[model samples]
Target: MIDYIMQYQSEIWQAIGETFVMVAISIVAAILVGLPVGTVLFLCRKGQLYENRVVFGTLNIVVNVVRSFPFLLLVVFLIPFTRFVVGTALGTLAASIPLAVMAIAYYSRLVEQSLLEVPRGVIEAATSMGASTIQLITKFLYVEARSGLMLGMTTSTISFISYSTVMGIVGGGGIGDFAIRYGYQRFETELMVVTIIIMIILVQTIQYTGSLISRMLDKR
Candidate 1:
């Protein structure tokens, strides 16, 4: 283990950094884009504020279509768009474009579900207090559903990390790329084990932290 660490220490560290970069950017983008999209989805559903079948149906179809595509296919399908956005689709930055896109679609559904978990009674109470649509969502729905929202984001982040690994197949550099190049291709079992360990550690850390935060924020 020490020998492997010493031998590929620099490469391993670099791969770790690249993985963080990809996951961090993608997850942040996912939260920013998904939050509003999901909120809109919730509001437009049957009997909710701003409800409209045409609008809800249209957005629903788009989200489902994007989400249903396999990650690998999405990666390939978005190559042209990724190139146009990032000027190249073979590096960390380029890879992040697809990661963010997929994350947005996946996380939006999670966010929508989280928002739906908000109690209808709370919404009614807020409405009785003369809460505007915006106020009801911002104050009642968001506050009440924060715990679920956090959990959803947590789950999405973990999924993003796993998806980021697949980017390695497309030349997007990360620990996954490192594993493939050294561990799989070059038959370096120790290096592969190390990478796997690191990934497990990362996922566990995120899961624990997210759960803790969610628990703390959950008032009911």
Candidate 2:
């Protein structure tokens, strides 16, 4: 183990860095897009703030369709689109397009579910106080759902980390790619074990930190 680490320390670190970069970009993009998409979904639901059957139904269907695709297939299917957007579909940057897109759909649903946890009475009270749409969402809904939102973000982040690993199959650079190339392909069991250990550590750390924050933020 020590010898292996000494030999490939640089490569392992580079792969870790690349994985972080991809996950960071994808998560940030997903949050930016998913937050609004989810907010709109929450508002437009039947009998909610901006209730509109046509809009709500349309958005709901779209979200479901996208969410239904298997992550691997999604990556393969989006190759052309990813290529168009990023100018290539076989690297870290190009990989992020599909990762972000998938994360958006996944996280949007999480956001919607989190928002739904907010009490209707609170919304009604806010409405009765003449809270405008923006005011209601910003002040009441978001404030009430902040903890859940954080938890949702945490869950999405962890999930995307796992999904990002699959990017390695298509030349996306990351620890997963490193594991595949040197560990599995080259029959280097020690390298595979080390990468797996690193991944486990990364996931556990994120999960613990997320849970801590969620607990701290929970006013209830």
Q: Which stretches of candidate 2 lie over 4 Å from their true place?
A: none
Candidate 2 lDDT, 92-182, residue by residue in tens:
8888888898888888888999999999999999989999988998999989999999899889888888888888866788888899999
**Model 1 Cα lDDT, one tens digit per residue, 5-105:** 89999999998899999999988888789888889999999989689899889888989998999999999999999999978878889899889988888
After superposition, candidate 1 runs with Cα above 4 Å error: none
Worst lDDT run of 10 residues, candidate 2, spans: 164-173
- Where does the lowest 10-residue lDDT sum fall in candidate 1? 166-175
- How much does each candidate deviate from the true structure in C-alpha RMSD? 1.0, 1.1
Q: After aligning candidate 2 to the native by TM-score, how far in Å is the CA of 13 from where it should be? A: 1.1
Task: Give the per-residue Cα lDDT of candidate 1 at 189.
Answer: 90
> Between which residue pairs do clashes occur in model 2?
none
Score every model by TM-score: 0.97, 0.96
